[model samples]
Target: MNDITPADSAERRRRVARAIQRRMVAHVAAGGTTDFASGPLENDPAAYTDPARAELERREIFLKVPLVAGLSRAVPRPGDSLLFEEFGQSIVIVRGRDGVLRAFLNMCTHRGTKLVRAGADGTCERRGRMTCPFHAWTFELDGSLVGVPGRQGFEGIDMSRRNLIQVPVAEWNGIVFVRAAAGSDELDIPAYLGAFAPELAQLELADAAPIRSSSLAADCNWKCALDTYGEGYHFATLHASTIGVSHYGNVAVFDDFGPHWRINFPDRRVKALVGLPESEWPEADYGGVHFLFPNTVVVVGSGGPGGAFVRMFRIFPGQTPGTMSCRIEVYALRGVRADGDRAGEFAQDDAESDVTREDYRVAVDGYANLVSAPAGFTVVYGRNELALQSLHRHIARAIGVPL
Candidate 1:
């Protein structure tokens, strides 16, 4: 898929509007029957509890797959860099002076020391150089080792071969993705996105900028944390005090875009769109929750005090099998009051924290009970939870596990 032009972008918006209209009409006619999968699905408990299975997933799913590392705005300028760990691999994403975004293993060439230890993300003002703190070994943003201290001590060493190891990196619609494993230069991000590419492109994420970001360490398996956003079945019960007032209960429209899925939840105000034409329909009428295969969820909702905003939840495997880390970034549309504004950004974070904290609490409790349950314990996915089933099935296929 190609980047959406202005005409294509407007047409895509209309397409989404019409699709939402059709779903709303069908929903009203059906008296609130939710979209469903072929049948209920069961997941093996070992997928979440077994260390051996976790290791397999780390290889096949996390390392082999193209994982979203950060947003384009994270390194918007040529000298900016972001560092983070994914599945035990520390990665550095830097923008070169030539305006190219590249990713490398965040290790020193001399003694395997980390090149950037300031924090998760920072800006490099040395123009084209990344200096290792240990020995002051310098490298260009393109991963070329340009300066090495005590060069005479290593007479036969080839600086070209000692440059930082370059990993597979690609950017699609302002989202940066990297393959952490070595020799993974052939991963095609667009092909990995499949049918979901166009829809993501329609969001015009490249034009939107991040206003605020935060990370949380959760006490649950990575899949468990991801499962929280795959379904709306718990909205009324789990989020009753938070977001339940605005959304309907257990009602959603589901679409499978290849291995990924999109779930649209009609809020209480959706009924107002019954008589409006597609052109008059607003995109904010429906809450769009998209699962970008493997480990990301993009939620589009009202911007609370401003306009609409997109919240991206990038989930990663923690140090242990039963833990996970999540980085949430909030991006506002252009010309919105919240765009690049600190106070508006704080409001977005506060709103997200309210709902997310509730979800994480439930996940932690559920994981505890799941692991302690009797042998052969399994988790059942209701037909309404089709996205959740799709996620597990994709992971199973990737790791050579049976359904």
Candidate 2:
């Protein structure tokens, strides 16, 4: 792991990009990881197969820590919201008329049925208020109860106390995060982000717009499926026919800010930068996958410089340790989406989908084995798989477990 501290500056990005390019070009020449000394760690198979441990992670990590809801740009205007139904609970992350983002338990104040039904894309369309599908109870974007049907029938019902219950919500850079449990002061995202804050800002996510979105369901542990996104070692065997053809396999650059990281499997085209002067190197294709701690991946698409894009992957644990779901949201800078020259329009929808399918196919099959693997077998992360190692390590520390 070339654990360069993640920096917030454009110069740092430029420098880091060039350095990674140079390093990757050399690795392409050497055909293996040689710069870092970190190594293969065996993790207990029980971690992925144990319901007891999965429940612990659910309580400590998923519910306690702030989880990614969606992009801020998805709800850029007042009264916009999306249903974030994960962990068997429904919640709505909404924006108010006063331009503040708030989250509410999706239950109606009257009968406890879901008040908002999201469209096929997980977004809700409302001018400023949402009425319950069951009782026609109305709520403002800020979750204040405004109107009630049959008010006289239900006499002495205090509307003030019937407001929608609120949970904590925060917007950092362009990412919107929510804590399932109710709390106000604890969701300091910037503080939680720590050194990763500046690196996230460089993506300019707040100014971007959502283009497309999709979801994946897999029969594997959530962390097992998530590990697929943290390393490039599998490209040679697993993605050989896809990403392997265009990008070098088993080679990458790693940088970290606490548990968060930026790991890139460089473009083979970067080999052109090997002997050339650094000043003459083009800055158009310097990109990497940024891993937000716990469960989110922001792939800063390197489809040339001006036409920037990002793909976000948010994974959620299922009821059992052997099942999980993932949400994939694609976004691009506002103007770039409208530009005629936007890059990889087909690649985003087709090629990336193919790659994700390949990843989960293996994860599900491997998980099947782990489920029955002798209560003692282990999963190994190779010497070069630094990001995966750090990820599991952080999860263990967070849940008070020994990895």
Each prediction's TM-score versus the true structure: 0.92, 0.92
Q: What is the lDDT of residue 164 in candidate 1?
A: 90
Q: How far is candidate 2 from the true structure (C-alpha RMSD, Å)?
A: 3.7
User: Best by lDDT, which number?
Assistant: 2
Per-residue error at 171 for model 2, in Å? 1.1
TM-score, cand. 1 vs. native: 0.92
- Please list the C-alpha lDDT of all candidates, in the order they appear: 0.79, 0.80
lDDT per residue as tens, model 1, 259-313 = 8888887777777766677568565433488888889898876565555678889
lDDT of 1: 0.79
Task: Determine which window of 10 residues in candidate 1 has minimal summed lDDT.
Answer: 118-127
In angstroms, the error of model 2 at 7 is 16
